[model samples]
Target: MTVKSKKYHISGERLEELQQIAEENMFMHASQLNDWRGKLNIFVKGEGVWVEDAKGKKYLDSLGGLWYKAAGYGRKEIADAVYNQMTQIESSPSGSATISQIELAGKIANLYPEKSSRSFFVSGGAEAVETAVKMAKKFSILNGKPGAYKVLSRRYSYHGGTAMAVSLGGAKTADPMGPTMPGAIHVTNWNSYRLPYSGDPVDVAIKCANEFEEVIKHQGPDTVAAIIAEPVSAAFGIQIPPQEYWQRLREIADKYDVLLIADEVITGFGRLGEYFGPMNWGVQPDITTVAKALTSGYAPLGAAIATKKVADAFTGGPEETFTHLITFGGHPSACAAALANLEIFEKEDLVGNSKKMGNYLFEKLLELKKYDIVGDVRGGLGLLAAVEFVADKKEKVAFPASAKLAQKLPKFLFDRNIVTFRAGDIISICPPLSITKNEIDYLVDAIEDSIIHLKKDLNT
Candidate 1:
C-alpha cells in the first residue's frame, strides 16, 4: 500500500494565495487569533501515525489530531465508504432517516452500556452533549418532573464549545461575554495529581464523587435533571477515577432518580482500550455523549445513546416530540465513514493494540518521573496518558503561568518533529490507537530529550 511518497511543498504563487487568503483571514480554534494569525503550520498529508506539512517535513502525531483518528491516517477503506455513501445519498432531510443512519445508530446502541438503547445523531461533540442535556430535560418533563432541568457536571471537564456545553465546562471555559445557561452547575472532580480535598488519592476520589450527591441536595434534587461527567476527565489531565468513585455516582443518580450522562467524547471508541468507556466502569449511564473518534475525524459525526428507560419516555405523541434538529445530523456519508472505522477497529484489533501499547507507554512514562521537570504521570487505560510538569518535584508545585513552560516545551518537540497536545503544564500522550511499539519508543525518547533540554534551559 504505497502512499504518495513524493515531497509536497507550496513554494510558488499557490503558497502566497493560501497564506493571503486562508492563514491571514481565517482564525484557528482554541488559539489566539491575533498572535497566530499568519504563523501557522500547514499540514496537507497524513499516513499512519505521521502527518506531513506543506514543507514535506513529517512529524509524529502524538495527540491523534485532537484525540480522534483512532484508526490512524490514510485509511482508504474509510474514504471509499464515505465516497460510496455520498453517491447514494449525501444527506437525508432532518425529519427523514437514511440506511446508513439506521445501521450506524443500531451499531452505537449495541456498543453502548445499555443494549436496549436508542441513538440520536448530531454533527460534533458539543452538539452531541447539547442533545443529551435537552433529552434529559425532556425526559424529565415526560416523567412528571418538569423542574428537573439543571445539569451537574464536574469542574475542569470540557464538554464542548456550545453555550450549554460551555456552561457544563464550569469556570475553566465558560464564556465571559455571555451568562452561563441558567441551572448548569459544576462540582469538584477527582484530580489525584492535585487533590482538591484533603485526603489520599483513592479517598479523595470517593469524596469528590460524594460531592455530587451533596451538590444535588444543595441545589434541590428535583431541580437537577442529570449528573454528567466523563468516565476519565481529560481537560485538566487524564484523571482516571477509582471504581469507588464510579460506584458512588451510580448510587447517587439512582437514589435521586437523576439521569447519569457519560461524556465519552474522548474516551470512547477504543481510546481507553474499551469499545465503550462507561461500560468499562460497570455502570450504565442513562445517556452517553460520543464524538471525536466516532468517525475518526474522517467526517463530522456524533451521537447520544440513551437507555431504554430514558428513550421510552419519548412517546412521539403530543409534546413528546424532540423539537430540536441538526441539519447535518446522521448524514449518510458520515455514518458510512464511522461504519468503516469501526470495522477497522475490529479487523485490526486496534482496541487490543491500544491496551498493549498503552501499558508500554505507561511503563516508559514512569521512568520519566525521575526527572525534576516530570512531576506526575497519569494513565492506565488504552492510549490515554498525561505527564504533568512541576518546578518542585518533591512538592508537586506547577510552574507558574509566567514561566510559559507549556508554550516552550512544544516548540522544542516540534524541532524534534513530534506533536502532542498540552493543557497548561500537563502534556497529553494519546496517539492513534493503531500506534506501533516502535512509534511509542520514538515518541517517549523525544519526550525525554525535550525534557532534559527544558530543564537545563530553565536552570539558567
Candidate 2:
C-alpha cells in the first residue's frame, strides 16, 4: 500500500487568512490573549508529543493541550480512524438510539470496575461531570429524597468549568466565576504530607471519610445527594489519597445513601497506570466521569459511567426515562476514534508502561529533595505527578502566586527542548504514556535546570 506524502507548507493566501483570523478573532480570546503579551503564537502541526508553531519552533508539549493528547499528536491510527468515520458518517444525535453509540457505550462500560455499569457519552470532561451531577440530583429526587440536591467536594479540587462542575470544584481559580450552583459544599482534600496527621495513611483516609459524614450530618444527609472527588486529585496538585480513603469513602456513601462520583478526567485511560483511577484505591464510585484521555484527544469525547443500580433507577420498562441528552454525544466519528484509541492502548500495553515509567519518574524526582525550593513531590503510577515549590520547606509555604514561578518553569524548560504544566506553584508532569525512560530523564534534567535558574533568579 502506497501512502501519499503531503507537504505541509502554508500558501500565501492561507497565511494571510491565518493572520487575519488571529487578528479578527483576537478580541474574542481577550483573556488568554492578554496573558500572552498581546500576541498569540499560532501552531501549525504536531507529531508524537511535539508541537511546532507557525514560526517553526518545536515544543516538547508537556502540557499536552491542557493534559489531553494521550497517544500524542499525529497518531496515524487514530487519525485514519477518525477520517474514515467522518467520511462515512460524520454525526447524528444519539437520541435514545444509535448503533455506534450503543457499541461505544458497551466498550466504555466494560472499562469500568463494575461489569454491569452503563455508559453515557458526552463531548468533554465538564459535560461528563455535569451529566453526573444531573443524574445524581434527578436520581435522588425520583428515589424519594427530593431534598437531596447538595454535593460535597474538596477544596482545591477541580471537577470542571461548567456551572455545576465549577461548584463541585475546590480550586481557587475555578471559583469567582460568578455565583455557582447552590448547595455545592466544599471540604478538605487528602494531602497527608502537607497536613501531617499522625497515623497510618489508611487511618488518615478513614478520618477523611468520617469528615464527609460530619459535613453531611451538619447539612443533613437527607439534603446531600452525592459527594464528588478525584480519586487522585489531578489539577490542584496530584495529591494521592491514603490507601484506605476510597474504601472508607465508599462505605460512608453506602451508609448515607449518598452517591460517590469519581471525576477521572485526568486519571482515566492509563494516566494513573491503571485502567481507571478508582481501581487504584480499591473502591468503585456509583458514577464515574472521565475525559482527557478518552479518545487520547484525537476526537472530543467523554463519558459518564454509572453502576447498574443508578441506571436501573432511570431504566424502568420504558415508562420512565432519564431526561438527559447531548447532541454530539456518541458522535460516530468520535466513537470510532475512541474505539481505535483503546485498541492502541491495549496493543501498546500503555497502562503497564505507565506504571513502570511512573515509578521510575517518581523515584527519580524524590532525588531532587536536595533543592530547598523543592518542598514536596506527589503523584502516583505513570504519567501523573507534581513537584511543589515552596519558600520554606518546614513551613510548607508556597511561593506567592504572583511570583509566576510555576508559569515560568515551563518556558525555561521549553527553551531547553522540554515542556511541563504549572498548576499554581507546582510544576506538574503528566507526560504521554508513550514517553520513554530517556525522555523521562531529559524531562527531569530540564526541570532540574529550571529549578536552578529560578533559584538564582529569585535570589539575585
Q: Model 2, 206: alpha-carbon shift in Å? A: 2.7
Error of 1 at 332 (Å): 0.8
Go through the candidates in order and give the clash count of each.
0, 2
lDDT of each: 0.85, 0.80
What's the lDDT for residue 256 in model 1?
91
Candidate 1 lDDT tens digits, 1-460: 2244465656557766787787657867776666455556788889999998776788999899998989999999999999999898788765678888889988887666567899999998999999999999999888888899899998888899887888898545444756887998878878878788887777888888888899889989889899999999888689888777888899999999899999999888988888877656788788988988989999999998888998888877878988878888877899999999988988999989988999999999899988978889988788999989998888988898888886788888888889765544888888999999899999999888888888887882
Say which candidate scores most in lDDT: 1
Candidate 1 Cα misplacement greater than 4 A, ranges:
1-8, 171-174
RMSD of 1: 2.1
Candidate 1 clashes between residue pairs 3 or more apart in a chain or in different chains: none
TM-score of every model versus the real structure: 0.96, 0.91
